[model samples]
Target: MTLDDPTRRRAHRAVVVAFLAHGVVSGSWFVRIPDLRDLAGLSDGGLGLVLAALGIGAVVSMPLAGALATRHGSAPAMRWLLPPLLAVLALAAQASAPLTLALGSLAFGAALGAHDIAINAHGVAVEHERGRPVLSGMHAAFSIGTLLGAGVGALAMAADVAPRVHLLAIAAVTALALLAYRHLLPAAVDRHRTAVRAVPPTLGERLAPLRRRWLLACAIAAMASFIAENAVGEWSGVLLRDHRDASPALAAIGFLAFSLAMTVGRLTGDRMVAALGDRRTLLLGGALAGTAWALVALVDDAGVAIAAWVVAGLALANAVPIVFRAAGARRPVGPDGRPAPVPAQALAAVSGLGYAGGLLGPSLIGAVAELLDLPTAMLIPALLAASIALLARSATGGERLPSTAARSRPAANASPTPTA
Candidate 1:
């Protein structure tokens, strides 16, 4: 219940609100899956292909999402982006053609990716302004939102509400949340104006910060951790039903447990990071995640396996936020006191990679599960968590370009002001 520092409290609240919206919007789609499959008369593989289209859209959109976010600021971009998402979700629910559904999925994915980039970019900005670690808790709000959305959607389904209708209700809820939250969302504080670009600045002096090995390693760790988180969130229900011999209702509980545990973990992550430091926290997370997966893969009992899934979710919850905070704080300063490199943009690029992996998680898990069984699918997350732990940083400074690197900096847009 204790929020972060008061200076960035509004930003933090905005992040939590946006994430809650994401949970409802994203979860509403999953809630409608049975109807979508029936409406399209899709075989299991066929339906999966449709779902894969959503992932493909997210992958394709991430880079551009980052650029747009940087240029426009998260406030304006998110305002423009979310409406389309609701529309697309509705369209996907009602589409008669596979092509139409595919298109809707693309829009859905694009909106999701765009929202993600804008919000997280905005988050980094807020974190920079606050000079502390708050990203993990914001992300934890996302996990909580997901859990709530899924839970509400499930209850609607139990009451026999049609998928399309259920989604309409969810959309209404999201819209109301947006309206309620609009006034509270923070505006971009970096006031210097520059021409927004369609393509991200690839060669700007700003790109200098990412030249270090540390940045690359952190990026890779983020990618791997995100892949683990997304795979479990998206596929845990499927695994339970298909491999563990659970009823649909029971299988859903597996995902709920996973989501709820993740939420609780993330909610507590800021405190953990404060106490344990990012390195030790990452190490502990990796061990817990790996052990949980190992249990899932090796165990035959349904209840025990579900418990393991929850453990994994909790273990993996805060890992990515720590990585993002580290990445944002990675810029080496030059001697003259200017940022020697494009620190924000570099973090954005690394985040782009992480987002891509997250989008890929579901399809990759599905493909593996199709061939090797659910236990094998579960192993992917274990391996990924271990890799992330290996790559995670021991310590990092706040976003200060080292004094040595500051010597070569171009004058700020005005007085060499930081990025928006």
Candidate 2:
């Protein structure tokens, strides 16, 4: 089942398509939330609950998605879920009650959870097959797709398109695009040394890895990075409008600038990683992000803060992808004295923590803003982002400067060591 060179290249393209598709689905869905709320007949409070339902579903499914990928192979598991995931988007558009809308959101979140893990699992495999840093480009595709989907959704709204029609159209188009391009790497490519668990590990066994310095560092670093990212997307506009005295229209540009900078940063991230190496790249990114956030918080001017936000976006761009690179790099030694597949559990542990940070970080900042002030609360992300530097070595297990690929090659039969 090993992919030949042609198939490997194709799989790499497929993985990029998958990431883009997922991002489009997400971006399109977020833009239509107001319509969804109207269709569901919800107040702001009910909308919050429905939103919470989505997080709950993601929480519940993330681990389960990892387990499914472990058992069935990420390739097949991804294929199985694609249709249902898109279908949920269409179905949610039609939900006419609070409960039904919540349920549909829950379904959508579950699908998202599965979709994320499968794609990452498959993506890491593809990276291995290619002997280069590829995740950054894949992530860039996602960022670009988000922008594209958001634009489409905005246009749909302007055209007075119904939610049902707009969302259904997005769902159908995304599904077709993914299926048409999904030359996914065979499950065997990643499964070569994996020992499929016949029974689930005990609670202690599951918890044991968290105590590992590397895993703990990875989790903290990832959570910190996500908090910074979510903060940029969620709170930048508020910071612009309320604190910086910007017009609403001008305030909206904060996140757009951030997103655009992120897109550009990730598009060039692979080159940076190759030139500077994982540990150094993260260290520099962390310092830059921390400085950017600090400037945004401390500066009184809107334009200055917004410009700093762009710097923050650029700094945060490759941070999480590098963390994931470490998490998926070389496999642990299995019982047979060979490199095992990267455990799917890593998916649950890493992404689950990140999901929590993304969900809670904005709320936590908002709470602090309520209790104190917006500018003061903004400092929290500055501190959190700075912590990435402190945690970088542990997170990356000390990747060499200038990333010498031959020095970290994987076991026989697998491709070169990941650039992480």
Candidate 3:
């Protein structure tokens, strides 16, 4: 909230690490899943059962994140949650059986869910505090991080680096980097000033936002976004290598293309919101992604499929961020004209639901693929992309980024007004 502090800019820059680190860990783990499967010596069905623990852990721990983010703000949560998150990766790397792998995966999922909620809450806080839309860019950092982690994974494989060693090295580097970048916006000054007060929202008050129509709509829209996003993100590699008969090297390009498109879309998302407003931005994103998925469903060629992934990357860049920003901004303004402290709980709830979609998305695709083929399964994402229409009037009507003049005022005056 210290708009004039020299370190304020640094704080914004620092928050991106939370997102980037997560993406790196995730990308690294995803590429190394085969190693994990082999280490555990599990059949595909057994591996699938253990993997469910990850989603379960993520869902179960999110509410706890709500409490932490509300009470402590981003810095403490980011700093503390990360080491455990990093440690879990090493634990999973060393797992030698299904039970051990499942336990490690559960811990990893919990940490991942908690960190994701905390950082995104921070991103929204930073966005409101800075008076510009930075969530999109923070998300872009995640995509870039994924690309970097995947690149590292590829290099490690080429050099014959053991998966356990690769994971440990990345975790160490990321943890050290965390120590160096400890200047995230302070809890005292962060716009969620309820931290400074004797009173914070009651549990009922915090939970009340979830009952609202718009928030539910946002959650559903989030589900759709994740479904569309993962259709390509989770499966394109398999589709290319297994279905399209591409070489291993060529199949890797599927992920690269998806990640690059996401980076491009997110890098531009803030400007898109600034120019067009949230409703239009959401509408455009839905249309573009829906159309792209339809093309992917109809087209049978690998080139067309990869091209569709690119389009989906571009289409969904800002969808989830926009929903999250709105959720954080939903509380009523005070009589004195300062904005309400952002309800980290609300953001967490939406995220919990949104991630449910992410968890379901892959299975949904696989189920469809099993019943028919991968191309026909593409229709599911297309439908979900088109279903991103939960944009109710109460939740997201007439929302636009603040004007530069509005943002130039003092902190109390500059606080983002509740939207609903």
Candidate 4:
């Protein structure tokens, strides 16, 4: 489809809506973790284990979701997975026992993992159709949704609203969003299958790309980025309240600042990529994120620490998306003249490993905090962000930037090799 096609435009809007709903749902859960911990009567270590269960679920489900998307197209897979995800979200919110909550979290995480891959795959497809950068903008919508969700969650906390009520409201909104955008998603037939029409690969072939050097590098970058991002989302509020003596209402401000900065960064990310290219953006962003974390580790003032969180958010906003775009850009022709599972498999592998880092983050931090202190524990993500800065070349992939003229033209008419 051409960039000017009205259908393509509608699809773009649909994807943005989907992303927004995703962000709201995610933010609603994340912002309420402190409350949940209290409700379940769990220690920090216990809560960390619950969070780790969620990550494990996501890791288990992501590859299967990717395979499904590769076969049946992203839109259908997303449509099928979303309602169950919403249900699990509500279920998780209602759990009173630690075991029940952990089980609910596992289910919730599985749904989120599958839904994430499908939605991202759809976004990549839309980007290909439009022939310009849209993933960052779509992610911006997610950030905005999260910002709104977190803001509203904070208000609810201040008003003494119950977690069940708050989560149920989010579920209702998510359901409405799905119904509104159901028809706008691209049809399964509209998706571009691999160039060759051979039978699908066996499981071994589907996973072959995991051994490639470039794909492994991309996975590591994704892991480090997630470690940093998830650390802020999961711990920022606790740090503010426990370490900085902020009130519950005020504690939410830390994540709020981070999400707001992320939204701004993503909204402008396309232009930045256009000017500086992916490598430089990753390097610069990683440096900024690393510095922010370092400042947070050293700074004693709560307000200054919040500012550091915002700076970190702005810097790391585009890191994972850049890696994803690079993964999507790779399209290897197989010996049978069919398309290999390079992009889809690479996305799943990287996302699974990356999510593992996110899963480990809370527990790791809690353990470190028990031994040392929260500020000292913050140093781990700081070091990881610095590692990302040093590893920025992984995103470059030795590819030339697409010419402006080429980018503006219809991608359908372009060569088969994908563009990042």
TM-score per model over all chains: 0.83, 0.83, 0.86, 0.91
Task: Kindly give the stretch of ten consecutive residues in candidate 2 with the minimal lDDT sum.
Answer: 411-420
- As a whole number from 0 to 100, the lDDT of residue 109 in candidate 1 is 78
CA RMSD per model (angstroms): 5.7, 4.4, 4.0, 3.5
Q: Which stretches of candidate 4 lie over 4 Å from their true place?
A: 1-4, 183-185, 188-207, 330-342, 398-405, 408-420
Question: What would the per-residue lDDT of candidate 1 be over residues 312-390, giving only the tens digit for each residue?
Answer: 8888888777766665543334322445333345556667667666666666776776676667777887788777666
Candidate 2 structure, TM-score to reference: 0.83
What is the C-alpha local distance difference test score of candidate 2? 0.73
Clashes of 3: 0
> Model 2, 266-326: lDDT tens per residue?
9999988888888898898999999999998898998888899889878888887887766
Residue range 1-420, candidate 4, lDDT tens digits:
233567778888888988898898888888998998888998777877888888888877887887777666778887888898899888899988899889988998899888888878777767767667778898899899899889889999999998889998888878877764664545542244552235655555544565665566667888888888878778888888988888888789999999999999999988887777778888999899999999888887789889998999899888877777766653344222345344555677667677777766777887787778888899989988877777788554544233211454544434444211
> Model 4 — which ten-residue stretch has the worst lDDT?
397-406
TM-score of 3: 0.86
Q: Output the TM-score of candidate 4.
A: 0.91
Per-candidate count of clashing residue pairs (backbone under 3 Å): 13, 0, 0, 0
User: Residue 48: error of model 1 in Å?
Assistant: 4.6
How do the candidates rank by lDDT, highest first?
A: 4, 2, 3, 1
Index of the highest-lDDT prediction: 4
